[model samples]
Target: MQPQLLTVPAQSGPTEAVPAVRPVRFAGLRLVHAALRRDLARLPNALRLLQPGDEPGAEALRRHWDFLTAMLTCHHEQEDRRLWPLLRRFAPELRLLVNWLEDDHHNLDHSFTRTTTLMRIATRDPASAWSVAYAVEDLAARLETHLRIEEEQVLPVMTSLFAPQSRVGTLGELLDLLRLADGPGAPDALAWLLEGVAPEQIEALIAECDDLTARQWPHWQAVYARCSAELWGPAATVE
Candidate 1:
């Protein structure tokens, strides 16, 4: 099952009971998860397109895979360094859950390494395509479980901690902390995250951007769109 990315508030309870934890908006995390799901869903097909004699398709798929790896690694590193520590402080009771998520990160890293290695092999020997496909499938399965649990356990806590009234910090500050990257290929990565997002969600994200970023956002979108068309030619929809 897909993890519900939206933060859901806890319901009302009795007088002596702990107050219901209200859900906080996490536009950034939700956006990231959506991109992860959509792009990952396409990896197997992308790999299949790279038969032994197809150098052009293989190169394109490799570029796509490289970008995906960067985005995923950047995301996990941000959370490990910033998000998780902040969350652990507020939800000390969730220590076990936090530990599991960290472990999942390690596991997923290993999965990415294996998948990348197989993909590299498949590039030279098309006979290795099946092996690459299996690796991709295995990675996807592991990610599915990790994302589900992360959405269920970790995201809610992040929302609660970042809730405006909670005084932990503003969503804008949280956005800064969770930024995926700012160097080369950053726009494509950002555009990738924004893919298939609802208009309202886009509006919400843009509203949080600084003036310079807001102005430059469209440029990034166009750049990534062009790159996407080139990478997934004639595929009508990349998502």
Candidate 2:
């Protein structure tokens, strides 16, 4: 369900800390933002290889675009389904900001769709390579803006709301929220999520994952490592 932008509650001082049985703090959100930034930063280089005279294979580029789109879609869907409603309920003061984030999601969806269309065209018509590259670059610019705002404003609000002592505090809840529909079994998505996250944060995320995720993670890491090297060249960072 969508948020009601109107009827916002008045901001009354600091909210009382709700007691909790198990106080677990989750840092998945910040790490996800970092992952997005890393991908966006590398995107320009990926696209640059597609300049008019460049010889990057169209099919390979299309696959790369598809992987990126899938990862981003999964991240946004998880936030929309699990994060926003919780924010609206517990952090009433951030209601307007939550609504704005929802709006940002919609805008990002449009950009993704447009970029995908360009990618498809480029797949069939190599002459359209520059156009596809331009589209991706544009998407990166918009995504970067959205991400900066989210990290600076929304993340702190989430940290305060989900503090360790909070009644709602549970790493499981946030970890589950971070999960995509394909679950933790999908190597590409998992790799993308872990990319650019700090070592400690990765440990924290792994600690909160289910048994199956923990069991499969090492194997998937190895598989994606090989795939990344093949796709981005040996020197490229896998994440």
Query: lDDT scores for all predictions?
Result: 0.66, 0.62
Candidate 2 C-alpha lDDT tens digits along 1-239 = 11111132444457845322221243445445555656656655665565454444556666766777766776677678777899889888888987888888988988888878877776666666566666767777888788788767776777777756452323344455445356343545666566444444455566566887778877776677666664567655443
Off by over 4 Å in 2: 1-26, 50-56, 165-185, 196-204, 237-239
TM-score of 1: 0.78
Listing every candidate in turn, what is its Cα RMSD in Å to the true structure after a full C-alpha superposition?
6.8, 9.7
| C-alpha lDDT (0 to 100) for residue 173 of candidate 2 | 47
How many clashes in each candidate? 0, 0
Per-candidate TM vs. native? 0.78, 0.72
The lDDT leader among the candidates is 1
lDDT of 1 at 87: 68
